[model samples]
Target: MKILITNDDGIYSPGIAALAKIAAAFGEVRIVAPDVEQSSMGHAITHSRPLSLKKSPIAFDGKEAYRVNGTPADCVALGLHIYPDTEVVLSGINMGPNLGNSMWHSGTLAAAKQAVLLGITGIALSTPVGKTEPDFNAFADYVKEALEVIFENKKLGLYNVNFPPQPKGLRWTRQSVRLYDGKVVPALDPMARKHYWITVTPLEQAEEGTDRWAVEHDFVSITPLRLDLTNEDELKKQLDSAVELNKQL
Candidate 1:
């Protein structure tokens, strides 16, 4: 299997290096990522300007690695073009977790999503961070296990995976859908210039069997995902209404 590894945390991030090392066991692994951090960039593509790929300044376990001057999605686009036979695209081992609704704007997940959009299997893996950097060596085995679980199921074209610092086991999970309180806090810099910071807080507790709950309970969470955003139930209701209106006319 040919695997393309990437991340939103930039080319120099230890998370990507760690992932590349483990993924080498699976297949031929190549690293292509942003030259600088592109966290929370979502599934954005950079069409306005020409993008460039350069040899990584740092080595990734001696893997062939390149850095791109674009978003996480752009890296995947260019990487797949360069290696058209890539079978799987693994994004992250991100610096932070991408659980729950945060997937909406997560560049880590975006890289994986891009792969799935281009008709390949894509998986995004992440873990929570604390005051210090995560000891990735401690969770190396779990990373391998996560890959095994994802690969065994060929039907799963896309997945969002999250691991607790020390996972007891793995669990199949669904995306956590809950309400949140979005906030914009104003602040002043040392120069007394006003600035604003946007953040969010969850309003409800995580539901059981969800990605958030699985990770909270110290299990690796793997949530299968799809590209479609359509609400089938709502579509059916709208179609039924249209039929009734047509009959009345």
Candidate 2:
């Protein structure tokens, strides 16, 4: 199987390197990632500037790799559009955890979402933050186990996997039911220019059976994320209600 690996954490990050190394054991692996960190870029694509693809000698266990001057979504777009032979797309092993409502803003998950849009299976992996550098060994093991499960089941959907600072075990999870408390911090540049930085503050509370809760409990959270956003059931119900209201009118 041809596996295309990409991440929002740039091509040189150890997270992606570790992911590439582990993925290589499964099949032919290729890396095409952002030239620089594109972390919270979400599913953004570069349209204003021309994208550049450069050959990178940076190898993860001697696998072929390339660097792209674009967002994580752009990397996946370029990979599938240019290399149609790619069977699976693996995003991340990201430095920070992507959980709860944050997944909507994560470039790591965006890459996987892009792959799913292109009809290829995708997997996104991430590790929680810590005061010091994160240990990639355990996360790599989790990735390996996830790969085994995916390969064996074949029906396992695209996943958004988030590992805690030091996960104890893996748990199939659902997206968090809670919302993020996002804020903007005002600051000034050295030149005395005013600016604001968007910051995410964790909520003081968490609901059970959520991705955030799973990670907090030291479980490697694996949430199946689908590309389709249509709420068919809700739409149908609304339409039925509208029809009844029209008759009453």
Candidate 3:
């Protein structure tokens, strides 16, 4: 089995390095990640500028590695388009957690989504949420266990996996039905130019049996996700209403 490893946290981040070590246990691993942190870039691809790929001597326990001047999605796109035969695409082992509403804006998860769009199996892994300092060391074992479960299941599709700060165990979960409480922090530069950074406050409430709740309760969260955004039920309902309206029109 050949696995392609990539992340939004840049090529040299410890998170990606640790992920590479674990992925190497599964197959011949190839690393092609962003040269700089893309973080919450979502599923954006570079269209305004050309992308650059450079071979890197950086080895994941002697595995081949490369860096790309692009977003996380770009890495997977280039990887599959260039390699064509890669069996699995494993993204992240991200520095910060991707849970709840964060998945919508995470480049880490976006990379995996891109792989799924290309007809390949993909998994996006993330560490627990934290403040000043993130404790990635505490979640290393959890990551290993999650990878084992993921590798054993061939039916798994594009999805997001989030480990708690130090999970007690694992739990299959559904996406949180709650939304984010967001805020923007105001700041000023020396030149008195105003700027704002979007900051996530916290969910006011979370329904039970969700990924957010699982993480909060000290369990690793695995939420199966898909790229399809169509609301089939709503679409059908609207179509029925349209038919009714056509009788008068």
Candidate 4:
């Protein structure tokens, strides 16, 4: 199995390095990631500008690695083009949590989504960060276990995985249909110039089997996701309403 590993965090980040080590045990691992952090960049591609891919010799335990000057999705796109026979695409070991609706804007998850769009199974792994530094070596075994399970079920399409700061076990979860309290705060710099900062505070509510609920309860949450966003019930309702309107006319 040829595996392509990537992350929203830069190629130099400890998170990617840790992920690469785990991936190396599986197959021929290729690490192609953003040269700089592209966190919360969504499922964006690099169609506007030419992408720059610089090969780094002996990077990530001597696995073939490259640094890309683009978003996480861009890295996956180029990685696939270069290594077309790649079986799996693994993104992150991200610096933060990508749970609930936050997955919509997470570059970590975006890389994985890109792979699925290209007709490959994609698995995105992330861990929450806090005041205490994460001991990745301690959780390496757990990550390997998670990857093995994902690999065993390759036809599952795209998956969004988020590990707790202190993970106890894994759970099959669903995406939370919850909203965050978003705000834009204006601040003044030293020069007294005003600038705005956009922020979102998550309202962590546990509803049994949701991704946020599992993560909040100290479990590794795995949510199988799909590219289709159709509202079948709504579509059926609208079709019925149209028929009624046509009869009236």
Which candidate number maximizes TM-score? 1
**Which stretches of model 4 miss by more than 4 angstroms?**
246-249
Cα lDDT of candidate 2 equals: 0.86
CA lDDT, candidate 2, residue 66: 87
Q: How does each model score on lDDT?
A: 0.94, 0.86, 0.86, 0.89
Candidate 4, pairs of clashing residues: none
Better of 2 and 4 by TM-score: 4
Estimate the Cα RMSD of every predicted model relative to the unseen true structure.
Answer: 1.1, 1.9, 2.0, 1.7
lDDT for residue 224 in candidate 3, whole number 0-100: 84
lDDT of 1 by residue, 1-249 (tens): 899999999998999999999998999999999999999999999999999999998977678999999999999999999999999999998989998999999999999999998988999999999999998998899999999988987764999999899999999999999999999999999999999999999899999999999999999999999899999999999999999999999
lDDT of 2 by residue, 1-249 (tens): 899999999998989988888988898998999999999999998999999899886857777788999999999999887789998899988988898888889999999989888888888989876786678885677778877776675653588888886668878888985656789999999999999999887765666777888888988888887777799999999999999999999
Candidate 3 stretches with Cα past 4 Å from truth are 129-133, 190-192, 246-249
* Sort order, lDDT high to low: 1, 4, 2, 3
What residue pairs clash in candidate 1, if any at all? none
Question: Which pairs of residues collide in model 2?
Answer: none
- Give lDDT: candidate 1, residue 129: 98
lDDT of 4: 0.89
Candidate 1, residue 159: the lDDT equals 93
Better of 1 and 4 by lDDT: 1
Question: Best candidate, lDDT-wise?
Answer: 1
- TM-score of candidate 3 on Cα atoms, chains taken together: 0.92
